[model samples]
Target: MFKEVLQQLGVKQNQSSAYHPQSQGALERFHQTLKSLLRAYCVELKGDWEEGLPWLMLAAREVVQDSLGFSPNQLVFGHKVRGPLALLHDGLKEVSDPPQGLLQYVEGFRRRLFLAGQMAKENLLNKQKKMKRLFDRNTESRVFCPGDQVLALLPLPTSPFCAKFLGPYTVVRQVSEQNYLISTPERKRHSQLCHVNLLKPFYSRFSESEKAPAAVAIASSVTEMAEDVKVPEDGILQPRLNNSETLKKLDEFVKHLPFKQRDELSSLISDFPMLFSDSPSRTNVIEHDIDVGDAKPIRQHFYRVSLEKQRHLESEIKYMIENNIAKPSFSSWASPCLLVGKPDGTYRFCTDYRKLNNITKPDSFPLPRMEDCVDAVGSALYVSKFDLLKGYWQVPLTTRAQEIASFITPSGLYSYSVMSFG
Candidate 1:
């Protein structure tokens, strides 16, 4: 099939066999001889092997060949090779004898070839040096200051080589001006203080307001009870608004609220806002009371509903909570149950033993003997298949292990109430 495909792609039978060593001995032998000459030339010149490739090719072309009865150059150009002095003498003779323009043309061709070879050598050396520098400087280090945030580059857990920069950590401690201790809440271990060159400052929405001022001025001071401006702490800076200014802002926030709610909000601000003298107040609270005149709250007796209907509702709620199928919050007391509907449109409930089964501990579990399994499968033709439907949901999780088993989805962090494993 592969041969047919290659033939269809325009690969001739002889060309296809060219890759085999036995079929291309002559070409392979030539390549070996060319490589040997290149190595010898590079060693003598104290240069890279790659630097001698073109020169080796030129030398090979000009060298006499036993098979061809002349140099490869002569075979191609239909002429005999000559030294520089011989060519020069020939050119003078040509000027006198006036034999076509061949001698002058050969001199111009030699000059062009020499110039091109020189340029190629310089370009190759420059490119090699650039590539070597890149490989030499593989790892980079960075630093950060106290309170500064930085992203930490880390490897992916599944494929460490395929890892990438994974974090935006906060620099909680500055060990030195050039090194800082970064903090990442999601990471299991704390990262070491890194050098300044590798650390880049994290730009956040609040960074602009956090910049230090050029000069200490009263305009940037915080206001106290007597309208007296206080200088900010050494590393700490105040926002544009002062305490009295913030109080006025708070008053403005509650202005649209009901009179009673506004008074309550003002009282809470007067107490809490006084403690944080430098902190800016950006939050507001509003409340409204609804009037339900002549309306009474509904009350139901448990005995009023049919036993089957009550069971049905409980089962539905249990299923909703177990599978995280509903957005409604479930109480901790909710239990797992099964629902059964009757022909009369009523439903019954059956309590599930899954909750109790979860609490029971496993006494003994066997470990996988991977080596033995591999040995048994050796030299055998076998098909491998995988099942992914309810892949994680099918596994049973212990009650004590459920907390760690909880995972975050688009909806929220949820612990499976039923057996689930991966």
Candidate 2:
């Protein structure tokens, strides 16, 4: 049945691969040209696609090809094909002989094809120009220099930097023309050289008002503005509050706490001193005359907690001891520390060497690429996942490197016992 169909279509017998539809480039090109002509003619006629198909077929049959030097219809039918009007205009047909008429028709078709090709080229060029303009308008070219303080934008949910924009990092070095090394107070060691585009300037003014209490002058300024403005029925004419004055009031409020409470709060404020403003009217004195009738005074005791984050240090030491992962000596000065909680509901220690990791040279290890994995897995496979608990702590830290393993905590400084992992 297939043979009969091929014979009816006048297809020649050829190698199976050569005749395969996928391998028939010429046939594919012909189909594409036919589709383009059908679409164009349909658009020109503003008619239904099905109604335009016959006319497109006729046009294609009459079209001349430079390579073949003849229309496909002429080659297939052994005669030139005519359009609808050719049969009705007998006089028009009589003026030219068969060969001469064919030549004129081919010439006319060739001219139209040339014009269409030119129009197509122009359309393509216009599209490319529009695309280039759009691209140029959207492309960002902002750049920064070394030593400039920048805020690094971090991905959620574990960013160590400000919960908002991560950094106020100083660009310490230029790792590449486009990448820079940045450091922050929280990050004791240098961070990985990051792309310049990832950073923006830290606008200190944005947070300045939040730090300190608004001044009396700010309050007076708002009051003055309020006094001058008339309140509108729609509340559209409401006066803006002076933020500086609000900050001053907040400062005054903080200064009235008792001495012990003030001391504790003061310690908290010390780290962010800019958050408070001085107020002459406020005092830190505690009133001792408060009645304690029939009530026994409770005694309070203070004990020093180790500021050194020992829990993290111990985890690192355990990892080093177990895995024997080779690492540099833990430097007391360089080791990064983190606070952890003890089993007894107290604080313990940990250290993060992420900054140090950034500086450490990366090993040239080969890993499987996604494409290779996809190919190897083919189209049918099930996958399972597992995780190692306390994976890093399972390894122990070297004894000589213990000093570098030291970390800072609220209580005191301490060293780690295990190899640490970021």
Candidate 3:
């Protein structure tokens, strides 16, 4: 029934020979690694491997393969999946800012899947060539042509005491570099595809006059013994942070807290390192858009600026373009730019959008009063205030709004890739 289902699904089943475990290169390597892991766990913990199986599997997924250039978990999840140990080292530095919205996650998943598939296909092709080289290097080479007779070691595990190596089968064909199809005349249905390791060439001891026509002819190729099994790599089971380093770092982190509450607060923050950030995060939780609503293009001429301000505006424009906050525009709408000086001696490149604002249709929906908002949050156990950083720029503008939000400058006409302050 399973075979029929597979056939209907356009899948071919390729089964290896029974009880001869050689030349299954990738599969054998995985099994060897799993066994090594289980054995080590048993030795260290003095317990059965069943309790540690889940952790062992997760460890395997976290290991990066040289051929794939990614861990199995990263290829599957399409994001950084840090185990607990990662927090000790990675959190001490910086957390990458990637998780902003659902769209980024979806795109990353698709990209990782595509890269993994391409990498796996290339790796398989190269592995075949590498295996052929390794096989040819350290062993005697033997090739069996068609029409050769062979004695195959076909084991019957159900009846262990029985003489299982009873095959005197004729060679059908060579399926691959080290695989073959062999069958006997009496039992044609018992034909099996086998590795070259399971076969041996048959020899005849009779003279020409006394010889019978029924001697076995075995065709064995020595190449089926695959490359040597690789030992599992040594790695830290669990990372440890020395007391001196932890205390020094912890002291710096909790220095501002009250002396009595430092220990408790430090523990709380340390327990959840992912929730804290050293700097303001630019998040895209709210997608703000400008709605001009069929207003005519407001084309204002460029404003005059001093040569010094012009140079600053040019540098600012270059920076915004490089960082993807703004882009060059060919829109029909534009407004004059302004240079507002900051108290810290730097000038802010501002846009004058009075004409654009005058033409735009207003949304006049009434907002809830402050008293009503405060009433709605009555009896709350906790209240937290978050001040968004570069809040206007964090939200993305709609495509149509972007054209309407364009501004004129000494350099050229440009549009905001993100929402911009007027």
Count of backbone clashes, every candidate in sequence: 8, 48, 4
Kindly state the number of residue pairs that clash in model 3.
4
lDDT of 1 by residue, 233-278 (tens): 4535543455567677786556668999988978886777544454
Top-lDDT structure, candidate number: 3
lDDT value, candidate 2, whole model: 0.54
lDDT of each: 0.53, 0.54, 0.74
Best by TM-score: 3
For candidate 2, the 10 contiguous residues with the lowest summed lDDT are 279-288
- Candidate 1 versus truth, CA RMSD in Å, comes to 29.1
Displacement of the residue 375 alpha carbon in candidate 3, Å: 99
Model 2 lDDT per residue over 100-129, tens place: 587887787777566555654566577657
Compose the digit string of candidate 3's lDDT tens values, residues 295-355: 6788989988889889998998897787778899999999888888766566767789888
